[model samples]
Target: MSRTAIVAGQGALPGLVAEALDAPLVYALDGFAPAIPAQTFRLERLVPLLDAMADSDVSRVVFAGAVRRPRLEPEMFDPRTATLVPRFLGAMQSGDDGALRELISIFEEWGFEVAGVDAIRPDLVPGPGVLTGEPSAADRADAARAAEILAVTGPLDIGQGCVVAQGLCLALETLPGTEAMLDFAALHQGLRPDARGAKGVLYKAPKPAQDRRIDLPAIGPDTVAQAARAELAGIAWAAGGVLLLDRKATLAAAEDAGLFLWALE
Candidate 1:
């Protein structure tokens, strides 16, 4: 019998993924972990962990939720991981996307197939449409502008999301993440005389050339509240290109905040 392993991280996403599969073996990262009980492993000694998974007849692996890259030191590395340090270091230097691709390649070398969360739970990718509240004309315009901005930045390995208010670029996501960008937009929105307190939309999309089988853009209930804090009109993401975590709660949050959730084309 074949078994699948869920290499989980923090948040509801891990639980949701576990629920989608049958008796999935759970492996939690040392720092970032799933809410459910799991066998914890560290990044430095990954080869042994892969060996363990192989022994258990695990043929597939799925990653979910937020995992920060671990800082590596020479002393901490096991023999196998140590040998791969040169390749891993080069991947990190390229960008987040590069790091994921390298990890995927390593797993393939171990004879395991890497699967995407959506493969198990297709419901998480909402169809193209408005889910909760309706978007205004301005919101649609801002959403379009945000998509265009992300397309330009995605190829540069910059970020997957941005905030546009009143057709003005308020903030762009970088290594600091989407929440930080939202907070910055909240602060800067009213500073401009022309855009004083002008409402906008938070936009999210997968970076072009990103490997969807690993890390795709995602949003949840917390996102709605964050956009509301920014005093924005709504949130939008590329339709079928992002994960809508905890669908019911996310929609409820959007409705309560009067923020439209747009799954844009």
Candidate 2:
């Protein structure tokens, strides 16, 4: 039988990818696949896994989900990882994209074909439009301003999304994420709560030159609910790069909550 390995990661993406690829799931840690049999392996065991695959009848391998950035403390470095430590550190110091490309190169060297989620779920990619109801003029103005600021700040790895109101930034998402940023904006006094309507505008986009293989910005129903709770006006995402998890359902929920969802080209 031709076997394929699904390398698991932290989020729903890994599970979804494994299903889509019809592969035997391999967990990075203690993950268990109830419906499909899977094996658990440590990150350092990757070299050996690749070696074993070479002897097997495996035809392909696919990576999915989010791998937590590996912690590089001394104690955590096994022999397999230690040899690559210097190169890995150098790449990280360079940039996120470089590091991801290097890792993908390592996998390819091991004879595994590295592929992106787009290969399996292209429909989930966002397209240009106001996905829900039309954004009011005020919402559009705020969204545009937020997108402009995001374009400037994102390349520096500051954050991927921002909340804006009446052409002023209400809150820019830091490490806390979009939901937390909106919550913070709702509590701040300077933002006009009643003028732009409930829910302020949220603009999300890729950092300029961001690696498409990893850390692509994502939005879903949870983001919409957070905006609703914060009374924000709308949500905007970059058209081609952002992942709209459960696109139709997310838009339906946003519409139900009277929130505008737009995808900017």
Best by TM-score: 1
Model 1 earns a TM-score of: 0.97
Best by lDDT: 1
Error of 2 at 61 (Å): 4.9
What pairs collide in candidate 1?
none
Candidate 2 global TM-score: 0.81
Clashes of 2: 7
C-alpha-based local distance difference test score of model 1: 0.89
- For each candidate in turn, the TM-score is 0.97, 0.81
Task: Supply candidate 2's per-residue lDDT for 156.
Answer: 72
Off by over 4 Å in 2: 1-4, 29-38, 44-46, 52-63, 91-98, 193-199
Stretches off by above 4 angstroms in model 1 are: 192-198
